[model samples]
Target chain A: MIVIDSPPLENCLGFLALSSYVMTLAPSISRIVFPKYKKAFLPKILLKNRRLIGVFAFLFAFFHGWLLINKRHIDFSDFRTSWIYCQGIATMIIFTVLAATSNDWSVKALKKNWKQLHRLTYLAMFLLTWHVWDKMSGHWTYVTPISMVAILSTTALYFLRLWYEHRAEN
Target chain B: MKSQRSKKRAISLGALMNFIVAIAVFGVGRVVWQGVGLRLSATGLESSHNLPLSAEAVPSIPASHTLDNQGTWIYTVALSPEGSILVSGGYDGQIKWWDRKTGSLLRTIQGHADAIESLAISANGQILVTGSWDNRIKVWDLKTGNLRRTLRHGDDVKAIALSANGKLVASGGTNNKLQIWSLETGQLLHRLPADTWIQSVAFHPGSQTVAYGSQSGQIQVWQLSQSEKPRLLQTLVGHQGMVGAVAFSPDGQTLASGSADKTIKLWNVDQGQLLKGLAGHIAPIRSVAFSPDGQTLATGSQDTNVNLWNVQTGYILGRLNEHRQAVWTVAFSPDGQELASGSSDATIKLAAVHDLAREAIANSPLAHTVPSERESDSQDL
Candidate 1:
């Protein structure tokens, strides 16, 4: 039987979550910063499937949590003691909340507060990124270029959008 | 109305396509990431080239010597028969001799132009043979720390084995060729072309046969006779990855091979058939050695642990989890009292096997969970 450590698989799942989360932000980018490109096929497709992608991201995050728990053999004692464990547990809680509210019924019930509650995705993404960076503190070479590109490009896009809005106001 | 229905169906199809595209991206991205990481790590280009950067951070394992300052990955380690001197060879292209008791660096012998990948000590403890990525095998007089002679190969030498009599030395490497040479004269006796890269070589205790394990997962046993060329005796095949180490039990009755597949397989030497496979290591098995009494087998793995297994029962006796990186090689002192493990973390750990095993039995709950011999054997088959 083939045996492998759970880290690589966990890292891959994390990357998938990050990638889908980044894609979910594409609609906002197109609408605010690149309205001329809003009608583009890629942007429109990503915009239409934003909710589905968000749900998939949370699903991948949950699986990543399961694998991490199995690998670390973490229990309530570990969750209470270690800061690294606390970071992971907190990240999983955020993802669970986001996934639970990702449906249309929750969107209608929460109404205006739905968008406010879904903003927790940003916090989840930040925690997930921090968790990955902490785990790979010394060994950054194993951190995939795709995750780096996705996270950085999303940040840059948001910053550019803010700069455009500020200049317009001025 | 018909156009509206078609548009809704198209949107559903688009969502399905988007999900498929996302999965494809994730799958392809993961594969590429893993591929690049493996290649970089294999070539020693990973960001953290050494694990546990300082000697102070090393775990408190009960080793007689925790020799540090090698400054690079140690690929192989050997203990002299007298158990007084320990030698380690590594990517630094230097073979270091240490006082086994004091853990002090006795001397540094350097001549190889590249990384030393393998080392073998003669049964008589007179000669030390080292094979290097420089495509050369150099024999040294252990007493005087003098280089006797150097034998050149077509490619980097990956493994070396010295006969019990200390007369014949078998060397194999990336060239896919196995060469048997006289240790005294450095004359090549026989050159056997192999099907794949030979990662490890070992001579039977009786010195009548030599076995080498290859990257293609085949272990070939060659019988050495007086006049004729070495005859291929048996080709044992079972491992799924490169067989990195091959060792014979002290009695020469059983041969154990450790592989990149993460399993150690025991073969009945006479029949050339797999008897049992030990499967505790979570990563590639880089080295394997049997204790002097031949009752315990030690395997060093990329998981950074050295596991000792009961030879007769295939039960895990204990695990030495001191190394912070891949444990490249393991060796038992001539008396079988001390076990030495070399790791990519650039430290050599020399622990008293008996004391370590006793402590593990008394403390570790996992030690009591070893599977039965019958169960392990059936599972292996």
Candidate 2:
């Protein structure tokens, strides 16, 4: 009998974080790209749960880092040393800060600064692109290329939303 | 003011965008599941008597033997000193012995509870040491198939090296601890802790020195003592990636290290100076071995290739692309006539060293730069 082995937990957690993070940003991109569909079923549901999805993304990313540190013995100092390793570390730290300030209490406490700080999600998205690229560039496995394509397409959608907003203003 | 048709079109586009995002999310899971399915089908094969190499890979060289692990990765292989018996340990947590000359299975030992990461044989081929993800080091009687001793570690073992005299075994792993043990007494001789994962370990063939490569791309050489703690000798830093394999030359003067950075460096074993950096493989190197004569170096990489290099000139003499997946380990027979490579493809391939070298030289444009046939013949003599 052929035994189908399960994929590594680290990879599963990483992919889950990526998916949830993408979900967190999808409503905003859709809002700009398809303003008429703001009241549509899919877009409305996504907008309603965006914050929950973002928090879930942070939790998944947190566990992903925890597994690497606790199980794989990855040194946290790698962020200061290697550029490739630093991308993921920096993204995780940004996600942590965003998650901490995600509450209404902190939103009221920080006021305008909370909005500016939460903008770091875009920075996380940018860093995550490089993190995926650096880890999967030379390695050709079954799931890596798919992941690369997914992350790139998501980033492209984010930029497309920005371009659309700029055009609308003009 | 947008028309109703345009509003309907916008909703469809939004739906399409949502669909794309959903596909991307599910695509990762689907691809990983598909990989598992592919592995499942591959594991059904009984033996890899004929390796399924691509047409481009087939014309290079024919392996003398293809020992199949039935779809589990073969992590490490070691040949006896006499070059007769070959022992291989792998992801299945089983060790298999093969008759090198006839390419026949001799025996199999199931000892490790998890994947066996490394294997080293004694100089006399009497004892075999295996390090595994099971967080244990096992010593086996090579001739009798008896379990000699089991040494426990704090974490899964990634690499191991047997000293030339067959008295000491050095092991390293995820624990960031490199520990030395006595083969006879099975006692921990020393424990050297580091700041990162220790991926590779090696012992000086002629001296009381040990070296280990860590995840931070640092190769640290230590001087062993009988009474006191092991003294840190040298910290060789050059590779941009983790050093996965390190081997001392037969004479024990030069240390060869292979890294995930896709380059191999030969270091002065005593002074720990980087003597030469050989760059040819496009992917991370997984294993490196020096020929018994110390003239040729063999290395395996995730590029699915086994490369043979002239040690003096740092020129690649041959490349064997027979394995379909990442080549995890390479070993030179005691006589250096044949080279055995274990791979993530679940096959251990034995290739003729001299024939591949001659073929590669003839095909290479830089053939004249390498030593001529007469010189190699004389060295063989």
What is the C-alpha DockQ of each candidate?
Answer: 0.02, 0.03
Best by TM-score: 2
Question: Residue B237 lDDT in model 2?
Answer: 91
Cα lDDT tens digits, model 2, B17-101, are: 4444344335434533544443333333323333222223323556878887777778899999999999999866899999998
lDDT of 2 by residue, A1-170 (tens): 22222335665688888888888787888788778988899888988767667767877876676665444323222222234358877887687677655555567789999989989898888888888766544222345556667778878988898898889899
Error of 1 at B267 (Å): 0.2
Candidate 1 residues lying further than 4 Å off, grouped into runs, are A1-170, B1-64, B355-380
In order, the B-chain TM-scores come to 0.81, 0.80
Clash number by candidate, in order = 0, 0
* Per-candidate TM-score against the hidden true structure: 0.58, 0.61
RMSD of each: 13.2, 15.4
- At residue B79, give the lDDT of candidate 2: 97
Which residue pairs overlap in candidate 2's backbone?
A: none
